[model samples]
Target: MRRSELVLLASFTLGLLTTRDAFAWCRTTTTQGFVPTSEKPCDDTGIPLYWSTRCVGFSVQRDASRWIDLATTRSVAQKSFDAWKNSSCPADPVSCTGSFDQGHPSIEVKDLGPVSCDCVEYNGKVGNANTIVFRDLAWTECDGTPKSDADTTLALTTVTFNTETGEIYDADMEVNTANNPITTDDPPGRVLYDFQSILTHEAGHFLGLAHTNLPQPTDKTKTPTMYARYEQREVYMRDLSNDDVCAICAAYPPNRSAPCDTTPRRGLALECGGGDPETTTKSGCGCMVLGQKPSGLDAVIVGATCLLGLGVVARRRRR
Candidate 1:
């Protein structure tokens, strides 16, 4: 019926610490979760929130951007996924200088081909995979971005999950081609939003990674990809920072194992076909009815009759 709130406010609201200093990465919390535990620890505060499975699925919209061809778009998307997939600890803390030689494995990010529509859905009658879509026009889908009514968001990642088990079912990304000039190649003097940079950032959210509130030191070149905001042509966002890799590895480890179906939310037919896929999963593993978009995943209150908990972390919030 409605979409859930994925905007994270903590990243901006809190004053950031230096990279040498340890800080917290914001996670989505539901009424049932966000509790306290050493294993599934919250921040200094107690809140248990993390993706319980690996092998997340995502799809790209068929209508390619005018600035880039369909093949180029998909290629860039795959490269973004690989950036995180290849991330490890040494890159962090300056090549794991402060940490040991423990290695983190990569999570599987499946690429399901083109589709007709680029809107978010949450009805049980149909099923869809996590999606990456391009909006060449104004963003009108979910009443605009989480921060305001105006269209200022460059891109977003909306994740749906089961509050009861902290299991994510669907995660989708939408890039704002209407507001920002997105491009694959760099032009002299003209600043353009790099597709790979933003895709890597959004993919972190899709894989259950959260934004870290830590600020980059004056001499630093790049912070975490999960940092709340990024500057145009900031290719540093294309890769995982130490914090980005650390939080992700902690949440969904490389060697971590689970029962996951990496299959696209829609089958191959929907991938090659030029239309939206079926919305319902007979086994009900894809999505369920939420009725309305949630306000904030971390602050959601679970009522007596509330359905299973689903966590969402939107990438557009300034805070």
Candidate 2:
């Protein structure tokens, strides 16, 4: 299958305007840009993408990144997830200028250690792993197909969900280590891509968030973690902005009743295939066959573009 068919590309052409401050968070919808028409319109428009379960398991590729060690990769991944997992609603509206709602998100992220498979895939017939992989050699689909914008993309998260209800079934994060120099150094002397900052932003995408649009002339310090573009050496995206907290709280409210299942939808497969070899399914909401694209479900691919001296806006792409 072609790379375009595999994942959606988040273009670095910011055209849509996203809200900012307390109520500026936007969720990934089955139908992109679907807003309900009402006088008292709700932010929860269309079928917003989300996980039904409270506990989600994320696994790191065994090989990790060529730029960073396996241990460091695991550590950064954990910290990135923690940034969102431990987020709480704003206590004081005055102190927190972007306070959106009350209560913490009822979600837990667990590290399932390293897995042999670095493929970005979701299997419906057998077990699956919500993997975090680094593309040290090339950026491609699970079948090793090169992405169209691999040279410009810093990271991308592919989320498979039920188009009818917008329930996310599986999500896999892929970092572009081949074209970008990913670093974990704190306050680096030179310009290098911060791993934690990038992953934390992608984690938000993993949790069902799209690139937040803010009006021009807004506070630059308060840019949401879900903001589309990267700022090269900046680490602000590593921590959750007040707007980021609002996004989490809005999606997974506190005390929400959900079972903690760390395992992927069907089960857990260290590798990719667990079903037929020749058959492939692209029909929204179906299982995938080896050497074939996913079926029976619609997948959304959100990406963060690298700031390689180009001033472009990035937006989520749907498939």
Candidate 3:
């Protein structure tokens, strides 16, 4: 198949976006309700485009040790941190580096004495420096700072890119169930939120992905990596879809496109509109469309026909 054709077929198999609403969230774990109807791009100034080069890291700290076990909480945070590193670091090691790895540009988790601030603040330290500190404030004890609606839940707040300081700060808090478990849309009941799931989403923000507005009219409906919702049963805080990987790759295509054989492989079935390949047209060629298995014979037939057409063209040219 032609390169473009191969890409399209791959996209169809992987299920590319068809409509804007496809990216919208049905619900959010935060009290802010669903993400606001805003058309903000992931990074207005384009800093995220180079974020991978800057080195992504985090520090988990606790203000007080009351609500949950510090060891358990740190373990959970580490799990989430590792998830981000594995998926995002393959392309840019500097930006996706974590404390576990022996790197300078990394995230650090520190214990601050108590759960004073809203869950934690990932503010860009040293004037936009890429750093995140996870502060677990045992409960509703504000760190002398007044709590606003924005700070109520363990929400990711303030993604600032400072050109002067060359730093980026992103912060958020962890929900403390010491007093009463917060109610959320997730299945756990009582403790409405899932720590890992919420952190995974926030980490995406830290990586510079914006909230997906309802996809454009021509896009498909699928769960996006940046979707503004939390899955109840999800435990790993770091999980990314092909689209997410594609976005990061596009932002930082290696100095040169890696040879096709060198490209990392993925294992998953690529479905388009819940239909077989015969009914779908290939979209684009990139890492986003690789390794998607077709679900039916129709898809195989479509692929075969395309390959045959290419063969015919090659023969005619040879003659």
Candidate with top TM-score is 2
Q: Which ten residues in a row have the lowest lDDT in candidate 3?
A: 304-313
The digit string of per-residue lDDT tens for model 3 on 39-143 reads 632323322312423334343443323444555555555565455445432333223222222322222222222222232222111111122233343333244
- Candidate lDDT values, in order: 0.55, 0.67, 0.34
Q: Could you give the candidate ranking by TM-score, starting with the highest?
A: 2, 1, 3
The digit string of per-residue lDDT tens for model 2 on 1-319 reads 5776544333222212222243355666665333323332224555777889999988888888767888898888889988888887754422234444566688877898888887766665667788888888886666677765665688888776665677887788888888777788897455367788888898888888766654432565567777777777777778787767877777787768999888787777787754323233331212111223335333333211111111124432435
Collision count for each candidate, in order: 18, 11, 59
Global fold similarity of model 1 (TM-score): 0.67
Candidate 1, residue 167: how far the Cα is off, in Å: 0.8
The segments of candidate 1 whose C-alpha lies over 4 angstroms from its true place after superposition are: 1-21, 31-52, 89-101, 142-151, 186-191, 264-319
What TM-scores do the predictions have? 0.67, 0.74, 0.44
Judging by lDDT, tell me the better candidate of 1 and 3.
1
**Residues 1-319 of candidate 1: C-alpha lDDT, one tens digit per residue:** 1222223344333323333334445554443223334343334342334445466556777777777677887888888887766766433432223452456544767677776556654322234556677767565453354322224467766666544545565666777777677777754544467777778888777776555656554644557777667665556777676677666666655566675667643332242222222222121212223322332334432111111221212334445
Model 3 residue runs over 4 Å out of place are: 1-55, 88-142, 150-152, 163-192, 214-222, 231-238, 248-319
